[model samples]
Target chain A: MQQLPREESLRLLGSVPLGRLVFTQNALPAIRPVNHVLDGENIVVRLNDGATLTSIAPPAGEAGLVVAYEADAIDPHTRLGWSVIVTGYARLVADPSQVARYEELLRPWVAQTMNGVLRIQPDLVTGFRLVAQPAVAVCAAGGEGR
Target chain B: MQQLPREESLRLLGSVPLGRLVFTQNALPAIRPVNHVLDGENIVVRLNDGATLTSIAPPAGEAGLVVAYEADAIDPHTRLGWSVIVTGYARLVADPSQVARYEELLRPWVAQTMNGVLRIQPDLVTGFRLVAQPAVAVCAAGGEGR
Candidate 1:
């Protein structure tokens, strides 16, 4: 496994359309699989009515709700893929025009009445990629022969 | 989307070898993609030396550390699959015999010395499956004609 740079990590994150959103529910961690889009450096997702995440309120005098978003594209058989994690604060896009813009860009996978939009401003972005090992022994043997 | 029974949820979880482990770090949410195995009703995962999870101690008088485990098998194109979330308390397997058994059962995907074993006793299990909607209108028309 190799650590990825922030720019590369965010790029990879934007490449995938689906990710898992993690947040605190009743002080315990809760995860939901949701489709997302990257708006510049921030991650955006749509929430349906009555969704618990829509009801999460930010702490008093805080920016937004602290949450983590994780996305990966690992091959189930070979396990060779990249995983990106973004820890950030998620805030609802309350502006009518901004919500309409997001609605035009992203479509919910499930057939639900999605009206709430969330924008996550990342605080920390980390990622890793699993790559096949290089043939170091062969290179060393060839160098010796030369 | 349809809800899955606890038994079916666990069975789907065991079928997949990879899952994301959600935990608290510095009082903020953190996520890690790790491979896991189901030991009956409990989920077991291996942690390497110096891993943060290995150092997580249960609160005083508490059964274990609270954590969440999520696994899913969704088709990227169709987005039709099942996702299972298990919220529970994680405890290190300190017994030598149990550790040895887990060591034999699971192999770490990364090339790291994984010596610590964690068993998550689930407190809540929930799952949902995304299925294509049936052609109800066509069936209803055929019934009316008959």
Candidate 2:
């Protein structure tokens, strides 16, 4: 696997609109696939106010919660692709103007009412790609495996 | 969204060969997509010996680390599907027979060598489905603001 640079990793992240958000819920980890938009370096996502995440969110005016966001573009057929991970702090976007702006830009995948907007400020970004090995290629083409 | 029963949840989990495993590294959350198989109620997975997960594995003959495993089958076009989450303890499978059995059943997507087998003993299983709402269906068929 090849490690992607920070800039490249962010670029790959922005290129995809779908990703998974991993956070802690009651001391256990939870993951949810969400639609997101890039706001400079921050990731903006719409969360349903009555959703599990909103219910589990830390109180307002508190320090942001640490979370991890992951996106991948692996081909289901070949299972070869790149995956990017972002570890950062997440908090509700309380600024009305910013929230309004994101509301017009990002659309929730589900039909539920989304009354909460959260932003993630990344501290670490990492990515890796799976490259097919030469030996595997040769063997797949009837070389040494034969 | 409709809540799925435990039996249906496990069935959906077993139906998928790929899922993300969420764990903690340095007090921060980490996620990785891995191939797995079902051993009754236990979720079995293979990790490369030199992989990051293996490096963080607790010492052999100890209680497994608590982790979360999530899998979903969401349709990209409709953005509707079922998601299953299993919170459990992850430990290296020291039993050679169990390791060998999993090796024959599950194949790693990458060409890297897999020398460790880990089993997750689920403590809690949760799953839900995103159902198409009537408003969404009507709006999609030219109802709202038309």
Candidate 3:
């Protein structure tokens, strides 16, 4: 199994058309897929229509927010896999001009109402890898082989 | 098109096999998914592997740690969706005896590791939806469209 470097990982995330965004609510964790674009060290996303808009819209103030972006090719050949996760806090784009700029660059896959532009202001970004490794032998607990 | 009621949305989240956990890291947002179990009003999650484990492992003195979680589903045909978001503190399960009790209920579909267990202690939980409404009008300022 080969490990993906941090730079490559960022590149994959920036370029990917679709990635999963994970957030927390109450005590459980949640994840949703959305279109993302990389700007400098930040990531821009647009939530067109769904529950996401409600949370980011009015009522929900500037409190704790977490957004994760993930993308990977689990299997290119013989279909195996790998998955990387990026977790961070995200804020809604207040400036219409900035929102419009990103809207032009990144388009939403979903076509419907409740559509609005939101940005994830990432704080602590951590990543991981899942590469298939060759089978290695492990000693049986009792050493009893039939 | 159909909308998922608050109760049903939560149930759907509980039923899913995997979900991404999003939270803030040093003011920046972060996200990762861990195997979780739904315990009625509160959602119990176990984080003992990969990005999630490394990020939110609570310190000894800390009893409550803030975090957020989200999950949803999209139907292509209907263009309708529903989601639930939970915000709360996540703490590590310390009691050696009780730890086993929580771990027993958690089931991992793919990767499972045993470094430590994390439980998201909910502070606030809410939900929302994105319903599709008919367009009032369409204006075509192009050459081909009539």
- Each candidate's lDDT (Cα)? 0.81, 0.79, 0.56
Per-prediction tally of clashes? 0, 0, 29
Task: Give the number of the best model, judged by TM-score.
Answer: 1
Model 2 / residue B90 / CA error / Å: 1.4
Model 1 over residues B5-84: C-alpha lDDT tens digits? 99999999999989999988888888888888999999998876436766784522457889999999987666689999
Error of 1 at A91 (Å): 0.6
Task: Give the poorly placed runs of model 2, Cα more than 4 Å off.
Answer: A49-62, A135-146, B49-61, B137-146
lDDT for each residue of candidate 2 in A1-146, tens digit (9 for 90 to 100): 78899888888889877788998777767777787888889987888643676665553476788999988877655667888999988888778888889976776667778888888888999898877776445533444433
Against the true structure, whose lDDT is highest?
Answer: 1
A22-74, model 3: which lDDT tens digit per residue? Answer: 65443345555666788876777777554655574332246636556665444
**Predicted candidate 1: what Cα RMSD to the true structure?**
7.0
Which lDDT value does model 1 have at B54? 62
- Candidate 1: true contacts recovered, fraction: 0.52
The Cα RMSD in angstroms, rounded to one decimal, for candidate 3 relative to the true structure is 7.6
Q: Chain A alone, TM-score for each of the models? A: 0.85, 0.86, 0.70
Instruction: Write the candidate numbers in order of decreasing lDDT.
Output: 1, 2, 3
